[model samples]
Target: MNRARHHRRARAFPLAMLLAACAVAPPVSARVQPADAPADATKASVASEIRAGVSGKLKDFYGPRGYWPLWVEKDAIGPQADALLALIASVDVDGLAPRDYDPRGLQRLIEEADASPTPKALARADLALSKAFAALVADMRRPARGIGMRYLDPEVEPRDPDPSGLLRAAAVTPSLTDYIQTAGWMSPFYMRLRTARADYRARWGDLPGITVPEGVKLRPGGNTPEIALLRHRLGLAQGAAYDRALAARVRAFQSDHGLAADGIAGGQTISALNRGPAYYDQQLALNMERARLLPGPWVRHVVVDAASARLWYYSKGALDGTMKVVAGARESQTPMMAGMIRYATLNPYWNIPPDLVQSRVAPKILKGASLKGMHYEALADWSANPAPLAQSEVDWGSVAAGRSEVRVRQLPGGDNAMGRVKFMFPNDLGIYLHDTPSRDLFAKPARHFSNGCVRLEDAQRLGRWFFGKQPVADGSAPEQHQPLPQPVPVYLTYLTAVPTAQGVQFLPDVYGRDGD
Candidate 1:
């Protein structure tokens, strides 16, 4: 047999034995107490009920431990049980329905067990709490279609927690409270969403709505009657004329809502103002569902949020720095994806995509546009070692008409489309993070002006974060590949509602992917 087949059988052997042991183990009442020696009748009765109530994975977990209570001791609910119940009661903060976990029913069971201290009541409460925890774990890890988790493209599958493994770990933990709180069960990003949701509800859950009339464009130095309504809606002092202070507040509001921060009360800004706390709440809930698909916090990784046009670098599981990024335009929308960045390419060539060359470049060249300053070179074919050809040798008309094909590349230089360097993560989708020569676009508030790839604002800074120092070319080679000491995972996600220090900032769904 092959080595892989042998390895599979080797790993399956122990699992089979463990399952058999769990299936054949004697009941806790029989193992823990003999027929004549029922010194602790209450304990024996509770263990027997617990064994009869649970099945499947829960049975496997409890049977091996003599059916002992996980959440009760000495006929009283412990601190761990209290903590779990509280979290379940307020689980809406995590975009979860509290009723699904039945927090009220669990509480009633706990109260009855506390008052009468009967074996049946205690066993029921213990089983209920364990089942609630398991349900929570399953919900947090899996993306639910009912909660707006249906994506156009398949996302990176989240790692699901093992039920038996979690129970085993919780059984021996020193502090079950700490274990439930910080057990790496949910994604750290999801926790951030929870905090944002709670803060938003506390601050603006009941914010009164006051809509400004349409077609009212209030500039900074203009006097208008509509300015009064705008100021009131923004929570500023009532004013009749548009002034610098009101403009500044409007600009801040516009920035937070993903509008152009030009201090002008235009159509888009006024429309956003009309959408009060209800719209924001829906955004938070949708984003929380999206966060469910993200992996747990990593020691070293990069997160590129396309909706916000931003990038965050995490080192040792802490945010090291953030920078601006230019994502794909609406026409070529950037996709949500995740992969490991294995290396960096210095002085990289911008190999134009066939579609771009056929649609954009060939038409221009056909109209007598010079390729001298463009630094473009036409190649015979798209191979590792392709022969160079003059621009005039190719049939531009045929290429532009989609009747022919050709390979084109731009030499490394200041005017090259791909500026300086590019981080490579090989995938089926031809998308990677790279620098750009057009730095002016970064100044715009809504920066969505790329074909599909992500353009970094500070490529050198990101390079230094990846490799202790920036990788430099020797000035003699056209392209140089530098492998990283350790590969870092990069998650490209689209979060329309992002958490901020003050509260959640709702960004524009530029790609219209949010379905809001």
Candidate 2:
């Protein structure tokens, strides 16, 4: 993507666009009221009740406007009211409960006010609509339970939306429809999830429940009475004998559900098939909450979804490309975080983490293993320019016993753990994306084998995307720092429930972060 174009789009919509209007209009008193305006006594009564009824943000919002109704005009609900009510009704698409907003109650209030436009009735309806709008905006912005904070790293803090400012903007915007739809209130990624949720609900909301009996293992090229039931469960054609085609379908299902894709309808696979619509519905809701922690679509960034072991490059508010990735193993689970990739290190040395050195390398070295053949060396310190230390000078027994510690690093070569390059984000957690010599892991369906760092399937491809060309090393140097033209943001997130063409794919919670 063009740098200038990216910057232009990035600055096009500021966060305040949803909170505050671009140009403040004249005060409510400066504008003339409609011919059907209520009597002064009734208006005073309504304003007094509004002031008494609302507190906090709503009170502040309406106080400045003389308690005037934003959704009610000329004793009738305006188009803005209809639009807002419609949005509230469809809050389910955003993984929000419509009941929480009381859309039906709001609708009933509107109907009553329309039937008899009294001051008390109109005031009640107007206040209800404003409260509903505020609640919806709040939930969309920050979400309940801190936007899935339990599933995220402690470093990631979700930002809260300003309800008063949003309400003020909604009042002044020329077209409430456009403001609600295109004013950048919700993140584009969140909107995408909304669409996916709607699609999944439309397709699989009423999916039939089918349960193949437990303790029954059906493999391909086998004839059994349960084959027909299995086919029915998988949405395949009825067949008494499990054939190649059925097996292929079974494999696809197994892969999607995070099971071993051996094309066998084993107990686990059968259990997954029996996981009805309710499971997916809850999964989608959980993932939608998780999406709140992601960077907005306007920014140029790379997203690593730890759940699916995938990496996506997003530029110009759209996905540029994607590739397979290997995330942290269950034991050393990858944390959800956001950072900027400021530079890349070519011919990077795999600085073995201290913990790994204590657990793996120290034991081997104590067993008389040679570090030179492994391209490993001990560093005197972890400073920018630390001197190398001879292996003979180090006490391996104390290191393995956790009584002492030393810094160890692997030299840049074919046998190096870090293949050729490493993208540096520089966080306290010491997590970064790097090329790995172990490429076979990428081909696996479940690729969480790292120790809390992300391993790129094709570091050269990512380098080309990041630097417009693959960075190279002169072989004379190791840990060559190549600064990027501009820093690109990287967001590491987890989404156990991923949207797919057929329906939502519920990946296994490898780290058990999803509370499943």
Q: Highest TM-score among the candidates is held by which one?
A: 1
Across 1-516, the per-residue lDDT of candidate 2 in tens digits comes to 001110001112233432232132324553555542233333444455565577777887887877766665544556667777667777767767988988778878877776766556767888988888888887877755644333223333455656677688677656666556542455555666676677666754654577777788999888888888887776767778799888987887676555678999988888877777577677777787777666554457788989899998876545788899899999988887777788999888888988889999999988879688668999999998999999999999999999999999999888787788899888777789999989889879899999899999989999999999878887758889999888887888888877655444677889888765
Candidate 1 TM-score to native: 0.67
lDDT, each prediction: 0.75, 0.74
lDDT tens digits, residue span 427-491, model 1: 76678999999999999989999887999999999999999987888784777889988888787
RMSD of 2: 10.4
**Reference-based lDDT, residue 294, model 1:** 65
Each prediction's RMSD over C-alphas, in Å, is 11.0, 10.4
Give the TM-score of each candidate.
0.67, 0.64
Residue pairs with backbone overlap in model 2: none
> What does the lDDT read for residue 255 in candidate 1?
66
Pairs in steric clash, model 1 = none
